[model samples]
Target: MELNQLISVNFNLRKPKSSTPTPLYMVVYYVDDKGMKVQAKIPTGKKVHPSLWDSKRQQPIMINKGIDLTTNQLSEQAEVTAYITNCRILVYSEKNLNFDEIKEKINLKENNEMSPVTQQFISAKKTPKATKAMEVVLNSINESNKSENTKYAYRKNYNKWCEWLRDTKQVDSMKALSQLKFNEFKKWLVASGATNAMVNDTCGYIVRIIKEIVNGEGAIYGVKEVTFKKLATTSTNVKCELLEEEIEALKDTKTISEREEFYKNVFLLQLATGQRISDTYTIIKGEYDVLKDDNGNEFIIIKNKKSTRGAKVKKSYIPMTKEVSDLLQVLQGNELIPTNDKTLTEYVNIEIKEIARRAGLNRITPNGNPLYSEISSHYARHTVTTQLSRKGLTSEQIALQLGNSKEMVERVYKHETDSDIIAKLQPAAANTPAPQVQAPAQPAVAKDKDLEYYNNLSDDDKLLYTKKLNDYNVLKDDFFKSLERQPERKRKAAAEAKTREIVQVWGFEGANDMEYKKLCFFLDLIKQDINDLILTYKVYNDEAPQGGMISAINDYERLLINIGKLTYYCHL
Candidate 1:
């Protein structure tokens, strides 16, 4: 029988009380290997008014008395829906399990939402290995130099991972950190509908934490190695930033409540300082000086919350621009924001979007949504980076202001339009086309010495270097085309040949040293191209290209790994 035919699920109200809420139960029916029909009745630990549940749909009805659901009502419905879907996935994915085992798994997952006393009782029953592993992970997180908010996040995710291990894999926590179980965990996350960015961070943190554990005390955990491959980073939302006018509008806007005013101030401060929402708490809560140099240039030094553990410079020097100075003046001697960091961040995220929406900042996002809907505390960092670049600050200077690496600023924060780039170059050569070398009518060996080293190249030579880079990119494009079309038998050889041709054109064979200018420049140029390729492949996979999607995704993952390596080496 087909998998879907083998397993079926539906919901039932236990008491079917008309006027009040009642417990919800899910019934799973499946046929065992011996062809015995079996049923597992699992309580969802959620309740809804019997009238609100649609028996046919096994979902909560959204309407009563010709009215739309309230926000809280909608949230409760969503939670119930999520629970139902999760139960279905569990039943279908584990069809091989007998009725009793399936019931046990569902019960375990459901217990996560049970009362505090029940949850504690269930937790106490976990294996000693699981408890020890949790201890190691939590202790390591708390003892680390990561910010309090970051530690909180890590601990929360680690607990979820542990719960997942217990419920789904039915294993000790130490085993979940093993390579095989970690891969399963990734699959589970994807199945659970986690966004790409969420899966990336959640999995990435777990991998890092485990490595920290093994590196610190290898004997405590049973696993000798943890080599979990992380997923490619994908933009999960439209890239957006506020305009100068929008910032002004936010400044001019009136707030009805102290809370709204407080959130608005926090957001504006984020824009002025380019700090993470978490780091901004440090700036506000602590006593920091806005000092001046001998030249009377005002600046504030911020110890970046997320900087490397042993970096030489933990502080970023933010030059006090008018925006920063004005905000500081407004906030001076005022009572500090009366909220914790997490609540402050959440409130700011909500209020800032509403404020932008009300101000009529209706710019369309790249994904065709209104830009105001995409505004968040993090967009302030992007705005600051782009603004600094437009104002002609060097990359190094912008990095100092943002307290991040130049490569990171370029890769993540900077979002310039093509027109902006063209405008920046217009003063130098507005009308000049990209310099190109004349191709001989006959195929000829490309000269290696015609070009000076990239660093010493003249303007014309710089353009020619770009032209050569384009030539390499063109070869890469051709390689992908060929890879897409080649017969399965010859695809491997075709891929190797095309890749070698591309690399050979770029002349990366001999310049492998750190001091090699050509190698560094070449890597930097292709990093963006590789990123584009990953995104393109993602789209192609979604469209289910004629070439196997698995193959495309595999290639995409490989490109992701290579780019990660290249970025690392470039930074070195």
Candidate 2:
């Protein structure tokens, strides 16, 4: 029974003489703790039934007569040893013995007094205090009127913390709940692999339990008020906005037959309405108003379900662009948004990550985790408001569309229109061709060596040089065409065209193709050029023919140039 003694114990089933074939298990032990070879036998036959000692309720239970200690069972040995050491220390302290002296005395007892050691060993076998605390915590949590998911999470985390506390702190007395000890417990909790947020939550739960105990509630417990240090908030920079290229990539992702149509419709709706996954799922066809304003300007009243219960909830009035209406038409007859929120959010997040990965926008954190420089679905609202604000919508106007207050609009939507206007002006300057620099008067006495150096190249070298120059020109042409095809470029072109119309009305000539090209580049400087163009011209009240003319001209020129360059390159 001594902490240092070695023994082997085993349980055997036996029947009593009076018992009618009722089987029971008996535990036998061999002790070497006192250096006196001794054996103890205890009968755990059916004659003794398990009982709840405090409540006098009979229950079936296994009796622990003794434990066999071996080096192979190191964990079990450690547990038994800790219990014995804690008990001996408590007894020795009460007797006013020096701590080290008490340890030495206990170590000496390995040679004598085997019965007292056995008694102490048996006493320590009682159920742990944490087990009781856990029961109380679980019972309280179950009885509370919390959400099922919340309750489940609380139980799981509470059990985890209890296990960690038992193992690390070796808590026994209720007095250990003091603030200092609680701090130590928290430190151990963090060290035991719990995250900062998890640690905070677990500590919060523990505080609640302690409060109940201190206030004389059921299974009252007390601990010193624990003051936990706040963990630093982990800020993430996730890009939530769907760029034109990113949207294309998502659309291009291959889908299975089972989910192909569903996935496509879901993504398209997100792009069109910028609705969060939760709101997107509940959007019904009737909730949308397809009527036009007094000026014949079409708009959609997106009746928010969260706000429809007459509880002063925010609601948004999104203008139904042709693109959004078309998508809704495609998605008709679906009771839900065709996908669950988690699945849709996860898919979009994965796609966003892949886009960032492909675009070389992935950044590394100090801890070596990949940090994305964008937001997630949670930031979709902010991105929508910012995008709308850049289109010359006032804060009040955006607030009305976003179902938020103007104060919130100004506070959250930080995209500045003035900055966008300045960005738009850059292309105009670039397109205004610099005065053709006049060549310096040619020197009559040019060096003959320089002229000969250029003239002495071989036919093969000349051909290679000419081909390289042509390839360079072809690449330049393709690059510029891509810029022209960009949506932002179209917006810039339309804005410039509007400016040119004003100039024309005052007898000024419209910009030539070169000026228009410059405007395209300027428009490309803005984010989400294509979507912005669609919003600005197509959504707003610009004449279709005029708007179409500008977009079509740019598209046609780009196609022709690209085709011509490809043909010339192939022939070369």
Candidate 3:
């Protein structure tokens, strides 16, 4: 249907059963595919009676009889025009348009325009009215260029909060996101099946959005409508990691499907590397992923994908163990787990839990509980972190091992046990050097006596001896480096030999006096040409008259070539 030629819209007053104001109803008329005239009715959701409705214009008359644009009543009439325009757009659309899509378009446009920041500068007389925190959040989503995953997380968490709020009928708008009510919301989220971490993350996103509104640095929210304090919802530690034996069992257990096996290998690699599922599952064994140290040892280097805007991305090189190297070899020239992260997580979790069951490593606690209550993709990380912690690795070291921040290791990875200080106090290894029987050289000490004395020294004395060892090593390196160079006498001899070869090649031994005189004349001319060329360039540019320095240089080169021929002729 040609919308411009055939389509038209008309508005009719909706008659209420009683004598009361009712919204205008829209009717769209166009020819159908079968060449029959058709009409569709859609509600404008704007209240107007028979007297106010303009049937010919098919638009509602100004809702306000007054001539003021600033009046709230005029705003309502503007909204009616907005609705009518939305219907006209739908009627003119080339594609078959649905009511839902039209409604969504209107809502999206309204939400975009409904920002407090946009309204703030419009009217300075009145303080900006606070909207819902959700509105601010939705606006941020529309404006944000964050990664899809981060945006999804923000929207998902906000939706969950919205669901809870709608049930309680609290915090339905930005004006209600006050600190006191927020505390109630936070408590409600926690009580309503949200784990502490979930509640913290969900509430934290809300708090951050609220703070952005108050700061007015980016998108502004309405002026503070209600006083509120920040929520204290820091993420709590989650203590579910695999033990050594459990990890071993997971390795030993086998799967039946290639897909399951793919996830299993992915899990093993993640466990070994402590990489996130995003990095681990889609690993490609290419040259860029492999790093070789100065000593030529190879490592797999990975940079995490979870970095904040303007933050330095976390990256680490994990030394390739035999198992990891073998795994890479198997996955060589192929993507090990070529699938989405969501599917990879499901396969890994399912196969890993089954593997644990088969190995009878499900639980081994004093209370007869399993090592992990639920095995998920993150278990690989938690397992690696906890095991490294048990091996006496520091938070910084663990963070590097897992490609994460030290604060993360301190908070989430560490499962430290009580230690006895006495156990750490042990005798240092004997520093006594092996005896050397040769006579003492100059600047040397008695080897046997010195070694014996060093062995009996205290910690401070031992530190001094260690420094001496370091100095000796440095001296040894310098001595070895010196071996690559020649002495001054040999260098001078080599220079003289080079000069002899040059003179012999010039035919000085065979040239007659006349030929030598001719060569000297050419050399003098070439030298003079060089002098003139340099003077010409220094005094003036090539554009100056008689300033052909480049041509003079070319002539000098031709003379030098002739001199070389003369030397060869003299040899003949």
**Winning model by TM-score:** 1
Per-residue lDDT of candidate 1, residues 1-572 (tens digit): 32324557888999876688899988877665667676767786679988778888888877667758755477678878776777677666664665656556566643433222344446555424644655677786798796655775676578657656655635465555677777777887877645455567678778777776677553444555566665665355756667886787677656655656777888898988888887777777754567899989998887787778777656678778887667766655567464566766766776786677555566777755566666789989899898878767778889987888989888888888787787776665553445548753321112234423565767676666666777886786787777778766666577657655665676555225333446545555555455445544543343444545346435644654553465466556
lDDT of each: 0.67, 0.48, 0.56
Clashing pairs in 3: 131-174, 132-173, 132-174, 133-174, 363-370
**How many pairs of residues in model 2 come into backbone collision?**
13
Q: Give the 10-residue window scoring lowest on summed lDDT in candidate 2.
A: 49-58
Quick one: best lDDT, which candidate? Answer: 1
Candidate 2 lDDT over 91-154, as tens digits, reads 3344343334334433433323312344433344432364465567668778989654456556
Model with the higher lDDT, candidate 2 or 3: 3
Select the stronger candidate by lDDT from 1 and 2.
1
Enumerate clash totals for all models, in the order shown.
0, 13, 5
Give the per-residue lDDT of model 3 (tens digit) for 1-572: 43223467676777734366686766667666666776766665468645545566766567436434433345556767776776566556536654444444433333333222345444443333334535665677767886544564566566666666665655244444567656767878766644444466677777766666666622343334333344344343345677665676567555555655666777788877787777675453343377778978787777766656698887766778888877766655554443466656655665665456545564544333354324568877877887666555667888886778899887876655545233234443332233547753222222223234334557675565455445544543343233224343343343334323333433344345335433443344334434544443533442333413344344435545655666666646
* TM-scores vs. true structure, each candidate: 0.35, 0.34, 0.32
Q: Per-prediction RMSD in angstroms?
A: 22.0, 23.5, 31.1
